[model samples]
Target: MTTCPLCGFEFDGTALSCHASCAFNERCAVICCPNCGYQMVDEQRSVVADRLRRWLARRNPPVREIGEVCALTELRPGQTGRVIEIDAENPVRSERLQVLGFVKDAEVYLLQTKPTYIVRVGFTEVSVEQSIGAGIKVLVG
Candidate 1:
Protein backbone atom coordinates (compact mmCIF):
# COMPACT_ATOMS: atom_id res chain seq x y z
CA MET A 1 0.00 0.00 0.00
CA THR A 2 1.16 3.55 -0.68
CA THR A 3 -0.10 6.95 0.38
CA CYS A 4 -1.34 9.61 -1.97
CA PRO A 5 1.38 12.23 -2.31
CA LEU A 6 -0.93 15.22 -2.08
CA CYS A 7 -3.78 14.05 0.16
CA GLY A 8 -1.87 11.75 2.52
CA PHE A 9 -4.51 9.02 2.14
CA GLU A 10 -3.39 5.41 2.08
CA PHE A 11 -3.97 3.50 -1.15
CA ASP A 12 -3.00 0.37 -3.00
CA GLY A 13 -0.08 0.76 -5.37
CA THR A 14 -2.22 -0.58 -8.16
CA ALA A 15 -4.69 2.24 -7.77
CA LEU A 16 -2.27 5.00 -8.74
CA SER A 17 -2.39 6.55 -12.21
CA CYS A 18 0.24 8.70 -13.82
CA HIS A 19 -0.70 12.09 -15.18
CA ALA A 20 -1.73 12.31 -18.83
CA SER A 21 1.07 13.10 -21.29
CA CYS A 22 3.53 11.43 -18.95
CA ALA A 23 5.88 9.24 -20.95
CA PHE A 24 5.39 6.16 -18.82
CA ASN A 25 2.16 4.33 -18.09
CA GLU A 26 0.65 3.90 -14.62
CA ARG A 27 1.79 0.32 -14.12
CA CYS A 28 5.36 1.21 -15.02
CA ALA A 29 5.46 4.15 -12.59
CA VAL A 30 4.04 5.36 -9.29
CA ILE A 31 0.65 7.00 -9.03
CA CYS A 32 0.14 10.70 -9.17
CA CYS A 33 -1.38 12.83 -6.42
CA PRO A 34 -5.13 12.32 -6.23
CA ASN A 35 -5.48 15.67 -4.48
CA CYS A 36 -3.03 17.91 -6.33
CA GLY A 37 -2.88 15.63 -9.39
CA TYR A 38 0.90 15.61 -9.57
CA GLN A 39 2.73 13.10 -11.77
CA MET A 40 6.21 12.71 -13.28
CA VAL A 41 7.28 11.10 -16.49
CA ASP A 42 9.70 8.23 -16.46
CA GLU A 43 13.05 9.45 -17.68
CA GLN A 44 14.13 8.05 -20.99
CA ARG A 45 17.33 6.04 -21.18
CA SER A 46 19.21 9.12 -22.33
CA VAL A 47 17.89 11.05 -19.33
CA VAL A 48 19.23 8.39 -17.05
CA ALA A 49 22.63 8.70 -18.73
CA ASP A 50 22.55 12.44 -18.16
CA ARG A 51 21.63 12.01 -14.52
CA LEU A 52 24.52 9.59 -14.09
CA ARG A 53 26.87 12.23 -15.36
CA ARG A 54 25.53 14.70 -12.80
CA TRP A 55 25.81 12.12 -10.02
CA LEU A 56 29.43 11.47 -10.96
CA ALA A 57 30.21 15.15 -10.52
CA ARG A 58 29.58 14.93 -6.81
CA ARG A 59 32.50 13.86 -4.57
CA ASN A 60 32.24 11.39 -1.74
CA PRO A 61 28.44 11.15 -1.62
CA PRO A 62 26.71 9.13 1.07
CA VAL A 63 25.06 5.86 0.26
CA ARG A 64 21.33 6.15 -0.34
CA GLU A 65 19.06 4.65 2.35
CA ILE A 66 15.35 4.31 2.77
CA GLY A 67 12.92 4.91 5.68
CA GLU A 68 12.64 7.87 8.00
CA VAL A 69 13.60 9.09 11.50
CA CYS A 70 11.50 8.33 14.54
CA ALA A 71 8.93 11.04 14.91
CA LEU A 72 9.43 11.36 18.64
CA THR A 73 13.20 10.90 18.66
CA GLU A 74 14.05 12.47 15.26
CA LEU A 75 16.71 9.76 14.87
CA ARG A 76 16.72 7.50 11.82
CA PRO A 77 15.58 4.00 12.54
CA GLY A 78 17.31 1.46 10.30
CA GLN A 79 16.17 3.23 7.11
CA THR A 80 15.83 6.97 6.73
CA GLY A 81 17.83 9.81 5.21
CA ARG A 82 17.78 12.79 2.92
CA VAL A 83 17.22 11.98 -0.79
CA ILE A 84 20.37 13.11 -2.51
CA GLU A 85 20.13 10.80 -5.50
CA ILE A 86 17.76 8.75 -7.61
CA ASP A 87 18.07 5.41 -9.37
CA ALA A 88 15.76 5.79 -12.34
CA GLU A 89 16.21 2.13 -13.10
CA ASN A 90 13.29 1.58 -10.73
CA PRO A 91 10.45 3.77 -11.90
CA VAL A 92 7.92 2.95 -9.22
CA ARG A 93 10.09 3.90 -6.28
CA SER A 94 11.57 6.90 -8.00
CA GLU A 95 8.21 8.35 -9.01
CA ARG A 96 6.68 7.56 -5.64
CA LEU A 97 9.44 9.41 -3.84
CA GLN A 98 8.89 12.44 -6.02
CA VAL A 99 5.19 12.36 -5.24
CA LEU A 100 5.82 12.22 -1.49
CA GLY A 101 7.99 15.31 -1.49
CA PHE A 102 11.22 13.41 -0.96
CA VAL A 103 13.21 15.76 -3.17
CA LYS A 104 16.38 17.49 -2.02
CA ASP A 105 16.08 19.88 0.92
CA ALA A 106 12.80 18.28 2.03
CA GLU A 107 12.68 17.04 5.63
CA VAL A 108 11.51 13.47 6.33
CA TYR A 109 11.20 11.68 9.68
CA LEU A 110 10.39 8.07 10.28
CA LEU A 111 7.43 7.56 12.56
CA GLN A 112 6.98 3.77 12.63
CA THR A 113 7.59 0.58 10.68
CA LYS A 114 4.86 -2.01 10.74
CA PRO A 115 2.45 -2.55 7.91
CA THR A 116 4.70 0.03 6.29
CA TYR A 117 7.05 2.85 7.25
CA ILE A 118 5.23 5.82 8.75
CA VAL A 119 7.12 9.01 7.92
CA ARG A 120 6.69 12.59 9.08
CA VAL A 121 7.10 15.65 6.89
CA GLY A 122 6.38 18.93 8.58
CA PHE A 123 3.18 18.02 10.50
CA THR A 124 2.01 15.19 8.25
CA GLU A 125 2.95 11.53 8.64
CA VAL A 126 2.80 9.02 5.80
CA SER A 127 3.99 5.49 5.04
CA VAL A 128 6.81 4.90 2.48
CA GLU A 129 9.94 2.83 1.88
CA GLN A 130 13.39 2.77 0.26
CA SER A 131 11.88 2.74 -3.16
CA ILE A 132 11.14 6.36 -2.40
CA GLY A 133 13.16 6.98 0.72
CA ALA A 134 16.55 6.14 -0.77
CA GLY A 135 16.33 9.16 -3.03
CA ILE A 136 15.92 11.60 -0.14
CA LYS A 137 18.83 13.40 1.53
CA VAL A 138 18.43 13.99 5.25
CA LEU A 139 20.14 16.61 7.38
CA VAL A 140 20.61 16.98 11.15
CA GLY A 141 20.03 20.43 12.51
Candidate 2:
Protein backbone atom coordinates (compact mmCIF):
# COMPACT_ATOMS: atom_id res chain seq x y z
CA MET A 1 0.00 0.00 0.00
CA THR A 2 1.13 3.52 -0.75
CA THR A 3 0.19 6.41 1.52
CA CYS A 4 0.53 9.84 -0.03
CA PRO A 5 2.51 12.19 2.14
CA LEU A 6 0.75 15.20 0.64
CA CYS A 7 -2.91 14.25 0.32
CA GLY A 8 -2.98 11.30 2.72
CA PHE A 9 -4.69 9.00 0.24
CA GLU A 10 -3.71 5.45 1.00
CA PHE A 11 -3.99 3.71 -2.30
CA ASP A 12 -2.16 1.01 -4.21
CA GLY A 13 1.60 1.39 -4.41
CA THR A 14 2.88 2.47 -7.81
CA ALA A 15 6.56 1.79 -8.40
CA LEU A 16 8.40 3.32 -11.28
CA SER A 17 9.74 0.61 -13.52
CA CYS A 18 12.81 1.65 -15.46
CA HIS A 19 12.90 0.31 -19.01
CA ALA A 20 15.97 2.33 -19.97
CA SER A 21 19.17 0.39 -20.39
CA CYS A 22 21.09 2.04 -17.59
CA ALA A 23 23.70 0.53 -15.27
CA PHE A 24 21.89 2.10 -12.25
CA ASN A 25 18.47 0.63 -13.09
CA GLU A 26 19.03 -2.54 -11.07
CA ARG A 27 20.31 -0.50 -8.11
CA CYS A 28 17.54 2.08 -8.06
CA ALA A 29 15.83 2.21 -4.69
CA VAL A 30 12.84 4.49 -4.94
CA ILE A 31 9.14 4.14 -4.27
CA CYS A 32 6.48 6.52 -5.53
CA CYS A 33 3.19 7.14 -3.80
CA PRO A 34 0.42 6.63 -6.36
CA ASN A 35 -2.08 9.15 -5.02
CA CYS A 36 0.04 12.32 -4.85
CA GLY A 37 2.92 11.27 -7.14
CA TYR A 38 5.40 11.79 -4.33
CA GLN A 39 8.63 9.83 -4.46
CA MET A 40 10.80 8.64 -1.62
CA VAL A 41 13.90 6.53 -1.52
CA ASP A 42 13.46 2.96 -0.47
CA GLU A 43 16.07 2.50 2.19
CA GLN A 44 19.33 1.07 0.97
CA ARG A 45 19.96 -0.75 4.15
CA SER A 46 23.09 -0.58 6.23
CA VAL A 47 23.44 -3.37 8.77
CA VAL A 48 22.79 -1.06 11.74
CA ALA A 49 19.82 0.60 10.03
CA ASP A 50 18.30 -2.74 9.15
CA ARG A 51 18.63 -3.90 12.75
CA LEU A 52 17.17 -0.67 14.08
CA ARG A 53 14.23 -0.80 11.69
CA ARG A 54 13.40 -4.35 12.65
CA TRP A 55 13.56 -3.42 16.32
CA LEU A 56 11.35 -0.39 15.83
CA ALA A 57 8.79 -2.30 13.82
CA ARG A 58 8.56 -4.81 16.62
CA ARG A 59 8.48 -2.15 19.31
CA ASN A 60 5.54 -0.14 18.00
CA PRO A 61 2.79 -2.43 16.85
CA PRO A 62 -0.19 -0.80 15.17
CA VAL A 63 -2.98 0.38 17.44
CA ARG A 64 -5.87 -2.07 17.29
CA GLU A 65 -8.77 -3.08 19.43
CA ILE A 66 -10.07 -6.45 20.44
CA GLY A 67 -13.26 -4.40 20.84
CA GLU A 68 -16.15 -4.85 23.19
CA VAL A 69 -18.80 -6.72 21.23
CA CYS A 70 -22.22 -5.03 20.81
CA ALA A 71 -24.90 -4.06 18.34
CA LEU A 72 -24.89 -0.67 16.61
CA THR A 73 -28.54 0.06 17.40
CA GLU A 74 -27.97 -0.63 21.08
CA LEU A 75 -25.33 2.09 21.32
CA ARG A 76 -26.47 5.40 22.78
CA PRO A 77 -25.15 8.79 21.87
CA GLY A 78 -21.44 9.26 22.58
CA GLN A 79 -20.72 5.52 22.29
CA THR A 80 -17.75 4.37 20.24
CA GLY A 81 -16.65 1.10 18.68
CA ARG A 82 -14.36 -0.44 16.17
CA VAL A 83 -16.41 -1.73 13.25
CA ILE A 84 -15.82 -5.43 13.23
CA GLU A 85 -18.30 -6.48 10.60
CA ILE A 86 -21.44 -5.66 8.68
CA ASP A 87 -23.96 -8.47 8.90
CA ALA A 88 -25.38 -7.99 5.43
CA GLU A 89 -25.26 -11.24 3.51
CA ASN A 90 -25.34 -9.59 0.13
CA PRO A 91 -21.88 -9.06 -1.33
CA VAL A 92 -22.95 -5.81 -2.94
CA ARG A 93 -24.21 -4.41 0.31
CA SER A 94 -21.05 -5.50 2.11
CA GLU A 95 -18.94 -3.84 -0.56
CA ARG A 96 -21.01 -0.69 -0.24
CA LEU A 97 -20.39 -0.62 3.48
CA GLN A 98 -16.68 -1.12 2.93
CA VAL A 99 -16.59 1.75 0.45
CA LEU A 100 -18.24 3.94 3.06
CA GLY A 101 -15.39 3.15 5.48
CA PHE A 102 -17.44 0.72 7.52
CA VAL A 103 -14.97 -2.16 7.20
CA LYS A 104 -13.69 -4.30 10.01
CA ASP A 105 -11.71 -2.62 12.79
CA ALA A 106 -12.54 0.97 11.86
CA GLU A 107 -13.33 3.13 14.88
CA VAL A 108 -16.85 4.57 14.93
CA TYR A 109 -18.87 6.73 17.28
CA LEU A 110 -22.59 7.20 17.65
CA LEU A 111 -23.43 10.88 17.32
CA GLN A 112 -27.22 10.49 17.51
CA THR A 113 -29.87 7.77 17.48
CA LYS A 114 -33.08 9.63 16.70
CA PRO A 115 -34.70 9.81 13.25
CA THR A 116 -31.71 7.89 12.00
CA TYR A 117 -28.51 6.42 13.30
CA ILE A 118 -25.91 9.15 12.88
CA VAL A 119 -22.41 7.83 13.35
CA ARG A 120 -18.93 9.13 12.96
CA VAL A 121 -16.21 7.18 11.21
CA GLY A 122 -12.79 8.69 11.16
CA PHE A 123 -13.26 12.39 10.29
CA THR A 124 -16.62 11.90 8.59
CA GLU A 125 -20.13 11.47 9.87
CA VAL A 126 -22.63 9.13 8.21
CA SER A 127 -26.34 8.82 8.74
CA VAL A 128 -27.60 5.26 8.39
CA GLU A 129 -31.28 4.43 8.40
CA GLN A 130 -32.53 1.78 10.84
CA SER A 131 -32.63 -1.06 8.34
CA ILE A 132 -29.03 -0.48 7.38
CA GLY A 133 -27.88 0.48 10.86
CA ALA A 134 -29.26 -2.69 12.39
CA GLY A 135 -26.98 -4.82 10.21
CA ILE A 136 -23.89 -2.84 11.21
CA LYS A 137 -22.48 -4.63 14.19
CA VAL A 138 -20.00 -2.60 16.24
CA LEU A 139 -17.59 -3.42 18.97
CA VAL A 140 -18.20 -1.00 21.84
CA GLY A 141 -17.61 -1.12 25.57
Local error of candidate 2 at residue 108 (angstroms)? 0.4
| Global fold similarity of model 2 (TM-score) | 0.50
Best by lDDT: 2
Question: What RMSD value applies to candidate 1?
Answer: 20.3
lDDT of 1 by residue, 1-141 (tens): 656556776655555555567676443544555556654333333466567768876632343333432222233444345544554567886677677676665666666655555777656677766454444445543
Candidate 2 regions off by >4 Å?
1-67
lDDT per residue as tens, model 2, 17-129: 63365455755555556556676655642355577889988754343344657678767777788887799878898898788889888988889877788989888889988
How many backbone clashes are present in model 1? 11
Candidate 1's C-alpha runs over 4 A off are: 1-81, 130-137
TM-score of 1: 0.34
Pairs that collide, model 2 = none
Q: Estimate each model's TM-score.
A: 0.34, 0.50
- 127 Cα displacement, candidate 1 (Å): 1.0
